[model samples]
Target: MTDRRLASVGTAAESRLPSRYLTPMDLVAMFRLPSVETVYQWRRKRTGPRAFRVGRHLRFDPVDVRAWVDAQRKEVAV
Candidate 1:
C-alpha cells in the first residue's frame, strides 16, 4: 500500500506530504517572478530557501520554503 511504502521508505514528515514539492518554476510562480533564472541565482548565491538535488533536478521542501519566507519576514520587519 502507498501508506505503508511511504512510511517505510521516508521520514515521518515526508510520508505526510501529499505529492508536492517546489521546483525552480514553482518558486518563480510562488514569487510571481518573470523567470526561473532568479531561483537558480538564489541557489548559486546560497541566499534562498534550502534545497537539494534529486539527480539532475533541484527540489525545495515546502517546510524549508515556509521557514525561509518566515525568516525573510523577520528580516524585513526589523
Candidate 2:
C-alpha cells in the first residue's frame, strides 16, 4: 500500500481516523476542563474556533487553541 493509504488506514485503525492525531479528550485535558461532548458539538457547529483535519482525523494546533482560549479570557475580562 502507498504511504497515504497507510496513514489513512493503518495508523488510524483504532479510531477509524485517517491520521494519527489528538482526540477531543486530548484537547479537553490540554484545556484543563471537562467538556468533551461540548467540544465535539462545537466542532460540528463551527463556532468554537477552528481545527485541522489529517485524513479522517480531527486535530487542533496547540497554539491556535491556546490563542482562542486567550481571546475568550480577554472577552470575559472586558
Candidate 3:
C-alpha cells in the first residue's frame, strides 16, 4: 500500500495524522507539569485539549493541541 494509504489506516477522521500520537507523559513535558496526573485532571475537568481512547490508552491530536494552546493564549490576552 502507498504511504498515504498507510496514514489513513490509523485515524478514521484525521487521515493525515502522522503515526505519532501524544501520550499524557508528552503533555506533562510540554507543559512542564508536576506529573501525568495533571493531564488526567485536566481531562476530568474538561480544561485541556481534546483526547480520545485507543484501546486502553489515551491519545491526543496534535492539531487540537495547537489549537487549544492558541485558545489559551487568547483567553489570557482578554
Ordered from best to worst lDDT, the candidate numbers read: 3, 1, 2
lDDT (tens digit, per residue) of candidate 3 on 1-78:
698887776456454444487999988887899999999999999999999999999999888887798899999999
TM-score each candidate.
0.74, 0.59, 0.74
Give me the runs in candidate 1 sitting further than 4 Å from their true place. 1-19
Tell me model 3's lDDT, rounded to 2 decimals: 0.86
Per-residue accuracy of model 1 over 22-58 as CA lDDT, tens digit each: 8988888778988899899999999999999999999
Q: Each candidate: what lDDT?
A: 0.85, 0.68, 0.86
lDDT of 2 by residue, 1-78 (tens): 598997887445434322334567777775665688878888899756578878887777655665577788999999
Candidate 3: deviation at residue 47, Å? 0.5
Alpha carbon lDDT at 49, candidate 3 = 95
Kindly report which residue pairs in candidate 3 clash with one another.
none
- Full ranking by TM-score: 3, 1, 2
